[model samples]
Each structure stands twice: as C-alpha cells, then as structure tokens.
Target: MGRLLLVVRLARRDLRRRKAEALLLLLAILAATTTLTLGLVVRAAASDPYGTTRAVTHGPDVVAVADEPGDPIARAAGVVAASGPFPVAPAKLAAAGRESDVQVVGRDPAPTAVDQPAVTRGSWVRDGGVVVEAAFAADFGLHVGDPVTVGGRSLRVVGLAVSAAMAPYPGSSCWVKAGCASGVAPGTVLPPGLLRTPGLIWLTRADTVELAADPVYLIDLKLADPSAATAFATVHNGTAATPKPGRVAQGRPSLFLQPWPEIQADATRLARDSQILLLIGAWLLALLAVAGLSVLVGGRMADQTRRVGLLKAVGGTPGLVAAVLLAEYLVVAVVAAAAGLVIGSLTAPLLVDDTAGLIGAAHPAMTWATIGLVLAVALVVAVVATLVPALRAARVSTVRSLADAPRPPRRVGWLIAASARLPVPLLLALRLAGRRPRRVVLATASIAVTVSGIYVLLILNRFLNGNGPYDAAQVRVLRHVLLVWTVILLALAAVNAIVITWATVLDNRHSAALARALGATPGDVTTALTAAQVLPALAGAVLGIPVGFVLFAALMVITDGDGDRVPQPPPGQLAAVVLAVVVAVAGLTAVPARLARTTLP
Candidate 1:
C-alpha cells in the first residue's frame, strides 16, 4: 500500500507537469473509443424508431400479396389474425410542384385488428382526401389541407400516418411494375425506373378502383409465432420445386411476401452502411493512436530518465519506477474511455432517422459489453505504447541515468559523407533522421495512414456523386459518415505531426545548442527540424496513395464485390493530395520547431 501510494503521487505529479502531452494522450485514445462506440451502436440505434413505430401501429408479422384476389388469410397457416386484401396499385403523385411515383393503397374507413395505420395528423381516409405515410409526407413537405394530384384526380391531404407494413419513405417493399424490385439488395444500384424512389399514399376503396382498373391485393397477417414467417412465406409462395406429399407445388399463382425481419433490416440499411464505414475508420484511427502514442511515450521516456534515476537512488525499486511510469497513462486511458462512452451514446441518435412519425425520441442504451470493449481498446493502446519504454527506462543503471547527459549519436560513415555536400538544413535533417531511424519510420507510417484515409475519401466522394443507385437521402447519410472519418483522421494526423516535431526538437536540444555555439544559426536549426518531418511526410504521402487504393478496393469487395464498377481517382487529384499533405505537415511542424529552437539555451 505504501509503495502503491508513492507511485500514484509521482505519476500524478508527472502528469500535471506535462499537462499538454497528457491531454494529447487522452484525446488520442478518446477519438478511437468514440468511433468504436458509434460503430457498435449505430445499427441498434436505427432500429429504435422502427420498433416504436411497430408497437404504435400494431405492425404485421408478414405481408402477402397475390394477383388473383381471394382470402389471403385462408391461404397461410399459423395466423392468429389478418387484415387487408386491400387494393394496391402504382400511380403518379404531384404536390408542391414536385411529382413522384407512388403506390396508392385503398382501405376501408374503419380500422382493423392488425396492421392498422396510426393516423398522426387529421382524419382517416375520407371521400376525396388521402392520408400520406408520415415519413413520405415529411419528405415531400406535405401536411393536412395541402392539395395533391393523384392518378389524374385532385385530392386534399387528409392525414399523415405510419405503419410497420413496410420500411419508411423511399424504402417501400412493394413496386409498381415487374422488374422494379422491392427491398434493398447488397451492391444493387438503383436502375432508372418508377420504383427507384417511391412514396406511399392511402385512399378510399372507391377512389383506388377509379384510379387503377386492375389493382393487386395485399394481406397483412399476425402469426402466433412470428419467427415462422420465412417458412410460411416459402410454403405460401410455392417456391419449392419438389413439394412433400401434402405441400403446395411450384408454378402456382405469383405471391409476394415480406416478413417482418426483412422489413426491420431494410429500415436499418443506411445505418448499416454507416456502421461498416465507421467500424473500418475506428480501426484505422486505432492504428494512428498506436503510432502517435509510441512516439509520445518515447519522448516522455527521454524526459523522465533522470527522474527514474533519482527515485532509484532514493531506494525505489525498478518495478516501482515502472509502475509509476505506466500508471499515469493508464489513469488517462480510463478517463478517456469514460468520456468517449458518454459522448458516443449521446451522439449516436443524431446519425439515425428520427422523424417524429417514424419514431419517438431515441434513448441510446449503453451496454456493459460496449463499455468493456471500449476500455479494453483504450488500455491496449496505453500498454502497447508505454510498456517497452517503461521497461527500458527501469533497466538503466542508476549511476548512468543520474548523469543525465544526452546520448552520443551513432556513427554512420557513408551517411555523413553523403550529407556533407548537401545544404545545411538538408544535411542536418538527414543526419537527424538517421539518428532515430525507428521514430522516422513511425512518423512516416502516421502520415501514410492519414493520406490513405484521404484517398479513400476521394473515391467514396466520387462514388456518392456519381449516378450509382442511392437516393439523395442515402447519399447524404453516407457523406456524413465520410465527413466524420475525414475530420477525425485529419485532426489526429495534425496532432501527430506537431508532436513528432516537438519530440525531435527535445531529443536534439543538446546537439542544437552545441551547433549554435559552433556558429549554426537558430533559423538553420529550426529548418532542419521541420525538414526532417517534411521529408517523411512526402514519402508517406506517396506510399499512401497505393495503399489507399488497395484498402478501398478491399472494402468494396467486402461490402459489394463490385470493384470493377468503381471508378479510379484521376492521377492529378492524387498528386494534389500528396502535395497538400506535405505542405500541411510542414506547416503543422513549423511552430513547434520554431518554439523549441527559440527556447534553446
């Protein structure tokens, strides 16, 4: 207990003295944890609105449609209750100077036991007025008393409502004509057609009959065991070519069936896409965090060498010294993990669809599993970065550590000979880079990660802007995902550049002061420090271009397997990105290098 308390006090003092670096460490872990939490929770958050809508509307377990009109309930087994055999047909709807293709459903004025559309505004289906699906109404900015032209006839919007029969607006499950498919398919781009982005409207039976002479019939069923829907759909649709002795045969009347699980999955498709992207981005950020923290730990190790020696001289064991060094980061990691959990939970709902009609206000739930995962990641980052450095510091002899003099640079005969002919800044940068080759590699890798992320962003931006299958809303959602990823990547990369430059300055301060005494100007020392980082940034940017392409291709193959269809970014754009990254790195490192040089004794 005495040793533990002593370690805690020392760690606390160290953290307070290096407040900026401690904060940077905290932020690095926090960024990764926040992104990980979002990836884990987005899918569940998206389903909240649908679940609420389902409960409010008494949504069906399965919706079945047949061309030949008959009793839909009689054809299916295990149904506790059923509604519909309502008339459905595709038609054009024009309102507020905007025209859209819509599937109009004709229902009786009275409600049924199952699959009742919950009217959220105005009255239910009347003689000449129509009730629009709530999400659809909101998309088109329509309200009660607004005039709409449907199927060549004018009608006032009577009500707005929500139902669990299908997905929300622009994600309906039924199409107007053959070849216009329903439900979202992986990698399926929307072909130009009537059903690509459709709306839903409700009308009276008489009005629907007047609109379409031959309308399909729909039946909504509530099953005793909702989980049996897939089996029920197979049997009802007669999809099995070889039936059992008492089963229905293939080539029967065409029946379209949508199970509830499918409906819920469709509702969360946009969220799923965002989730996948964020999860990938979280991993990338984790890699950056590791690199950044490793460099930071190395810097801290140099700064704390004498402190370690002093403690050892005062009878502190190496184990106690190591504990003190590691404890500071562990405490910061814990705090960062907690902050990430709170922020991520509160921010997740904003990424989901939460229109008033689709769902009530979302209350994001934080599970113990999520907390455990986040903490595990944060601790892994801290341990991976700090362990080796702490151990090395602990193993140093007390007398040598207490000497507190800068270590001599290793001799590299060829490097010195080659650099002697170069300009002073370039010569100093090359010598400094060769001095700490491992740190240079890490700095290069950090820039590569950032540039690779930017490259992927460019590809995704182009894909979203192109004529691929997503609607405007989906495109917007995907763009939001890209924006989040870009912001985090750029911010962390900027932090890394400055940190690396500052660490270089600190490690070379003794040499720099000697150079000044030997007539090397402050300007030359600052330029050398900045140049060391800029050279690595340029190489990283160049290497990152191909890595980004490979990563984007792999992600596309995993998500859609349509790499051939994805257009490659132009060469000029990639070049521009590389140039921009180099410039940004130079700029980011400039202030830190200048400050370090100006403060030199």
Candidate 2:
C-alpha cells in the first residue's frame, strides 16, 4: 500500500508538471472513444422514435397492396385484425409554390382496429380536405388549413398524422406503382437515383376517386406474432408457391407486402450509414492515437530517465518505478473515457432523423459494455505506447541511469558524406533526420493518416454533391460524419507534428550548441529542425493518397458490401491535397521549432 501510494503521488506530480502533453494524450484518446460511442449508440437511438410511433399509432405487422379492388389479403394466415382495402393511387401535389409526387390514400371516416393514423393536428379525413403524413407535411412547411393543390384540384390541408405501416415521407416504399425498372439484361446494372422522393397524403374515398381513376387496394394486417411478417410476406407475395391450385389457375391478384421491420430499417438507413462511417472513423482515429502516443511516450522517456535513476538510487524497486510511469496514463485514460461517453451520448441523437412523430426526445442509454470497451481501448493505447519504454527505463543499471548523459548519435558514413555538399540548413536537417529515423517514420505515418482521411473526405463530398443513391437527409448525415472525422484527424496530426518537432529539438540540443560554437546560426538550426519534419511530410502526403483510396475502398466494401458505387477523386484534386498537407505540416511545425531554437544555449 505504501509503494502504491508513492507511485500515485509521483505520477500525479509528473502529470501536473507536463500538463500540455497530458492534455494531448487525453484529446487523442477522447477522439477515439467519442467516435466509438457514436457508432455503438446511433443505430439503437434511431430506432427508438420509430418504436414509439408504432405504439402510439397501433402500427401493423405487415402492409399488403393488391392490383385489384376487394382483394381478400386480410384472410392471409396469422392475421388477427386488419385495416383497409383502401384506395391508394399516385398523384401530384403542389403547395407553398412547390410541386411533389405523392401517394394519396383514401381512408374510411371511422378508426380501425389496426394500423390507425394518429392525427396530431386538426380533424381526420373529411370531404374536400386532405390529411398529410406528419413528416411529409413538416418537410414542405405545410400545416392545418393550408391550401394545397392535388392532382390539379384545389384542396385544404385538414390534418397531419403519422403511421408506422410505411417509412416516413421520402423513404416510403413503392405502394402505388413499381418505382424501379422491372427487367434488364444480365451484367447490366441500372444507374442509381432511380427512385423519386415521394410524400403521402390521406383523403376521403370520393376525393381520391375523383383525383385518379386507376387505384390499387391496400391492406394493413395485425399478426399473431409480429416477427412472422417475413414469412407472411413470402407466402402472400407467392414466392412460397403454397397457394391453392385453383386460385393459381384463376390468376389470383398480385400482391406486394411490406413488413414492419423492413419499414423500420428503411426509416433508419441514414442513421445506420452514419453509424458505420463513425465506426470506421473511430478505428482510424485509434491508429492516429497509437502513432501520436508512441511518439509522445518515446520523447518523455528521455526527460524521465534522470527521475527513474533518482528513484532507484533511493531504493525504489523496478516494479514500483514502472507502476509510477504507467499510472499517470491510466488516470488520464479513465478521465478521457468518461468525457467521451458523456459527449457521445449527448451528441448521438442530433445525428438521428427526427421524422418519426414521437412524443419525447431520444436519450441514448450508455451501457456498461460500451463504457468498458471504450475504457479498455484507452488503456490499451496507453499501455502499448508506454510499456516498452517504461520497462526499458526501469531495467537500466542504477550507475548507468545516474550518469544521465545523452546517447551518442550513430555514425552513418554515407549520410555524412552526402549531406556535406549541401547548404548548411539542408546538411543539418539531413543529419538531424538520420539521428532518429524511427521518429521520422512515425511523423510520416501520422501525416499520412491525416492526408488519407482528407482524401477520402473529398471523394465522399463529391459523391454527396453529385446525384447518387442517397437522398438529401442521408447526404447531410454523411457530411456531418465526414466533418467530425476530418476535425479529429487534423487536430491529432497537428499535435503529433508539433510534439515530434519539439522532441527533436530537445534531443539535439547538445549537438546544436556544439554547431553554434562551430559558427552555425540559430536560423540555420531552426530551418534544419523544421526541414527534417517537412521532408517526411512530403513523403507521407504522397504515400497517403494511395492509402486513402485503399482505406475508403475497404470501408465501402465493409459497410455497403458491393452495393454502393465508391467514387474516386480526380488525380488533380488528390495531388492538390497532398501539396496542401505538406504545406500545412511545415506551417504547424515551424512555431515549435522556432521556440526550441530561441531557448537553445
């Protein structure tokens, strides 16, 4: 207990002394944890509103539409109650100086036992007036008593309502007609953006009949087991091939059935995609965290060496020394994990679609499993980065540690010979870079990760801007995900670059002083330090272009599984991105390098 308390005191004191580095570590891990939390909670939160709406409206287990009127779809097996044989037809609606395609359904005046539309505003279906789906109405800024033109006939908006029988508004499935092309030759894929965004409206039977002469029969069924919807759809849609022989010979009405789960999934597809993007982004941020923390830990080892020696000289055991080193990061990791959980839980609901007309807001519950996983990841990052160095420092002989002398730079004959012919700045930069090749490699990798992320962002931005498979809301959600990813990546990379430069400056201070005695100016040394990082930045930026492409392609395969067409950014844009990264790295490292230069002997 004494040793443990001693370790805690030392760790806390060290953390207080190096608050900036500690904060950088916290921010790095926080980025990873927050994104991981979002990925885990978004899909769960998005479904809550849909479930609430389902309960409030008495939503159906399945909805079936037939080609002809008076079709007995309600007689299908497992159906205990049903609504409609209502007339459903496609028509055009114009309101607020804007026109849109819509599916108009004619419902009876009286409420039914199942699949009732819960009217939230004004009266239900009435003569010469129409009710709009709540989300669809909100989308177009329509309200009760607003004038709307349907199928070229003027009508008044009487009510706004919600139904769980289909997805809200534009995400609704094709009910009035087949929305996509029916057939095509093998290997000839259809172009995307085939489905037009459509809204839903409710009207009286006479008004619907007057609007469209051709109409389809719609039925919403309540099943004994709600989850049996898929089986019911298969049998009713005739894929099961279990229909009676006489009915098949008589050419029974063609029916299209949509299950409630399927509808719910459709409604939440944007959230799902956002979740996937965030999950992938979380992993990328983890890699950056590893890179940044490794460099930070490596640099701190030099500063802590004397402290380690003093502790050992005072009779502290190696295990105690290592514990002290590790404890500081563990405390920071726990704090970062807690911060991430709070921030992620609060921000998750903002990304979810609020189209489902539920009574309350979504509060994504933070489960213990999620917190444990995030905390574990944070600890792993800290341990993986600090363990080897801490153990190495702890194992050194007390006499050797007490010397506290800087390690001699390796003798590289060819590097020295080649660099001697260059200008002083370039020569000095080359030598400094060769002194710590591993740090150079880490800095390069950090820049590569950042640039690759930006590259992917450009491609996604282009895809979203162009007409693709996604709708407006989905595009907006993905853009937000990209924004989050870019911000985290840039911040981590900036921190890494500055940390690397400062570490280089400290490590080379004695050599730099000797150079000054040999007539090297402060400006030359500053340029050298900055140049060492810039050369790596250039390589990383170039290398990151391809890495970004591969990463994005892999992500697309994982999330969409060959379904989406992943677009590649233009070569010019990629080259420009690489150039910008190099320039940004030089700019970010300049301040620290200059600061280190000004303080040198």
Candidate 3:
C-alpha cells in the first residue's frame, strides 16, 4: 500500500509538472476518439430515424406498385396485413394567387390504423375543409380557413397537422430532370382531389367509382414487424425475373415489395459517405497523437531516467518504479478517453439529425451503448501507448541511471559520419535527423497521417460536392476544397519537420566540425541534413494510400453497387499533390541548407 501510494504521488507530481504537454496529448487523443466514436454512433443510430417515422406515421411495411387496372401483388401481400393500391390525386393549383401543381393523397384513411401520422396542430380530416401539414402551411404562409385551389377547384384549409408520414412535404425535388417538382407547389392545398379546380381531382371511392388518375404504384402493407418487413421484401425484391410486360406493367401493381430495405439502403448509403469524413478526422488525430507523444516521450525520457535512478537509490524496486512511471500516462489516457466519449455522445446526435433531414426522415435519439463503446476504445488506446515507455523505465539499470548526464547517444556519431558522404545539404540534414530515430519516425508518421487524412477528406468533400455519377452541378461543387485545406496543413507539418531537422543539425555544431575535419564538405553536410526529412516525407506518402482507402470505405454512406472503387487519380493530380508536398518540405530546408553549405571551410 505504501509503495503504491508513493508511486501514485510521484506520477501525479510528474503529470502536474508537465501539465501543458500532458494536456496537449490528452486533447489529441480526445479529438481522434471523439470523431471515431461519433461516426460509429451515427451509423448505428441512422436506422432509428426511419423506424421512428414509420411508427409515428403508421407507414406500411411493403408498398407494391402497378399503374395498370389489374395489379396482383397488392392483393397477394394483403394476406398478412390489410393492403391496397395507392391512389394518386394530382392537380394543377392556383391558390392564394399563386399557380402550380399539387398531389392529394386519397386512401381509405381507416384500414391501416397503426402508423397514422400524428396531428400536430388541428384535428384530422373529418369533413368540409382540408387538413394541411404544418410544414406545408409554414412554407406557403397558410392558416386555417386559408383558401386554396387544386385541380381547378377551391377548398378551405380546415386544419393544420404534422406527421412523420408527411415530413417529406409534397412535391419534393427529384434527383434527375431539372425543374421536375415532386412536392406540392407552394400556396396550393388539395385534399383527395375530389373538388375539381384547374387540375385533376381524387374522389372518395363512394363519391366516384371509376378511378380518375392512373395509380403509379400500390402500397401493399404497413406492419409493425421490421423483420417480417425485411424477409417479405427480400423475397419480393429478389423475385426470379420480374413478370412479363403488360401483365402487371401498366396501372397494375408490380410484384415488388419495398419496406425497411429501401429506408435502410438510403441510410446505409449516407452512413458510408459520412464514414469517409470520420476517417479523415481519424488520420488527423493519429498524426497529432504521434507527434504530440513523440515530443512528450522524447523530451521527458532523460528526466525520467534520472528520476528512475533516484528511485532505485531510495530502495524502490523496478516494479514500483515502473508502476509510478506508467501511471501518469494511464491517467491522461483515461481522462482523454472519458472526455472523448462525452464529446462524441454530444456531437453524434447533431450528425444524425442533419442526416435524417437530408434523407427526409425523423431524427432518432442517441443510445447509451454508443457512449460505452467510445470509452472502451479510449481505454485501449491509452493502455497501448503507455505500455512500452513503462517497460523501458523498469528495465534501465540503477547504476547507469544514477550517473546519467546529458550525453549524445552512441549511434549518433556513426550515423552522422555516414550521412556526411551524401549530397551537400542532404548529408547534413540526414545526420541531424538520424540523431533521433524515434523523433524522425514520429515526424514521418505525422506527414503520412496528414497526407492520409487530406486525401480522405478530399475524397469525401468531392463526394459531397457530387463528384460521382450522381453529381448535381447546381447544388454541389467538389472543386478540391478539402484537398486545398489538407495541403495547407501538410505544408505546416512539412515546414515544421524540416525546421526541426535543421535545428537538430545545428545543435550538433561540434559534431559537424569534427566531420568537417574528417573531410566533409559544407555542401555535402547540408545535403545530408536535408535528406533526413525528405526521406520521411517520401515514406509518409507511400504509406498513406492504404490509410486513405480505409477512411474512404468507412465513411461512405451511399455508393454504387459496383463496390468500393476509388476513382483513379488522374496522373496530373497525383503528381501535383506529390510535387506540392515535396516543395513544402524542401522549401523549409533550402535556406538552412544554404547557410550550412556556405559555412567557412
């Protein structure tokens, strides 16, 4: 107990002393974990929005459609639940002095009672006047008793209501065909199209027997059973070769069953796209993590070694000493993980809400399971990062630690000597970077991570801008904006890498002098130093491809059925990105390398 408490106290002291470094590391971890968690949570939660909307609207499980007179699938699927052919009541509109088209949903209004859309403002359509959705009302500035024309007939807005069923307002925009409207026109209100106006009218079945407008599709059934919905739909959608033409092609219900599959497919597509953004965010976090930890560990290792010697002199066993050294990182990790989890929980709902709205569905609330998973991942990362550092501390000999002084690592001299033979500036840069392998590796990883992130982000931004086959020129613009942003970050990272390498070389002035005495030209020394950073940049780029792909795959919400095919990078674009990275890194060393090369020989 005494040893444990002492170790804890020592670790706490260490953390307090390096509060700034620890906080930076913690923040980096938190950011990565939060982004990853949010992505996963959003993907998981996407299903619920449509499910909730279905529940609220009492939507049918399967909606089979045929435009012709004799549609059979609707009647066939009606076995499990009450089903019927969908009725379309479209009409031209001239309401509130504005003219357009409207669709009046005509149904029995009673057979399917489970998922009825809730009335938000006024009562259901009981008689005389029509009930309008709050969204429709708000969009067109309509209120109860507002007069509107549909199908060349006039009607009064009797009540206002809202439904998950009607969340997607009438006449929503279509994917193809510009100026093709899917939703009801603004300033127009039409009910069942029974009252004729300037357009078509849908009549109550008893009011008029022969169908006025040809039904495009049939809504087979709406059930509370999601599993049944899927099973039935799978069988229906996967039916062996859709039936021959006129049999059920025109004004008749096709044997297709669309249920949760349609909704799930849509959500899944969005989820895939979102995953790409999440991936880019992850790589950014990883870069920050590697850079931050490298600095933290390298900067503090010497101090820690001395501290270990002191602990040994005080009769502290290696086990106790190791415990003390490891605890600080463990604590930081835990805190970061917790903070990330909280942040992820808070942010995921916003993502879900936005996505739901994008797909025209209700937003589902977040679940506790998501929070738990995020915390679990955080704890794992914390433990993994601290394991090696803690072990190294425990294994250091007591005598060496007690006599430890600020001395160059043994391998530095040989590396510096070998690096001197390289090209002028590159030689010096290599030696300088070679002095700290771990730091060099971290820098390399940082460059690679940043590149990976940028690439993924660019891909996603392009996707959002409508880059694929579905590109909508008017709404989306994927003009490499994310690529630009990523390049900016990479530039910063590359500059920092080069500057650090140059500074490391400069710090070893005595070594440089020794090398100069050993026949190293100033130009050669400069070139060697520059090589150190350039090599890492090269490595980062090479390693970035897979990481970029992984992120792309994870964030894609909707994609063509052809599978995950990365658009082949144009040779020009690839070359440009590489050239830009090289320029940024090389630029940083040019002045420093020149100065070193110009040194008095």
Instruction: List, residue by residue over 1-601, the lDDT tens digit for candidate 1.
Output: 5988998899899999999899999999999999998888888888888888889889998887777569555445598888878888878899889987688898999998888888999989999999999878887889999999998899999999888887776566653433243323334555554343568899998999888887777888899999987777677765422111111122224677777877877677678778888888888888899889999999999888899999999998999989999999999999999998988888887776565447566567788999999999999999998998999999999998999778788778999999999988888888889898888999999999998888888887876776244556667777877788789989998988988988889888888888878878888889999999999999999999989988897787666546665678899999999999999999999999889866686
lDDT of 2 by residue, 105-160 (tens): 99988998888889989989999999999878877889999999999899999999
lDDT value, residue 314 of candidate 3: 87
User: What are the lDDT scores of the predictions, listed in order?
Assistant: 0.82, 0.81, 0.54
CA RMSD of each candidate after superposition: 5.0, 5.3, 8.2
- Model 2 sits at a Cα RMSD from the real structure of 5.3
Q: What TM-score does prediction 3 earn?
A: 0.69
Poorest lDDT segment (10 consecutive residues) of candidate 2 = 242-251
* Candidate 3, RMSD to the unseen true structure: 8.2
Superposition error at 533 for model 3 (Å) = 3.1
Q: Which order, best to worst by lDDT?
A: 1, 2, 3
Which candidate tops lDDT?
A: 1
Tens-place lDDT per residue, model 3, 1-601, is 5877887889889989988667766765676676766666656655666555566666666655445436655445434554445454444545678764444545454545533445555555543355564544554566777777655556667666543332233212111111122212233444442221111222333322222334343454655465676677667556422221111111212444556455444434344445444545554764556564644554565557788999889898888887887788778777876786676656655554332122244333355675566666665555555566667777788988887754474467677678657665566566566667776777677767776676665554543443332213211222332332354455446544654554445455566777788887776666666676677777777677667666556544333222233353455765566666666766776677667654433
Winner on lDDT between 1 and 2 is 1
What is candidate 2's CA lDDT for residue 52?
Answer: 85
The CA-based lDDT of model 3 is what?
0.54
Sliding window of 10 residues with minimal summed lDDT for model 3: 170-179
Number of colliding residue pairs in model 1: 1
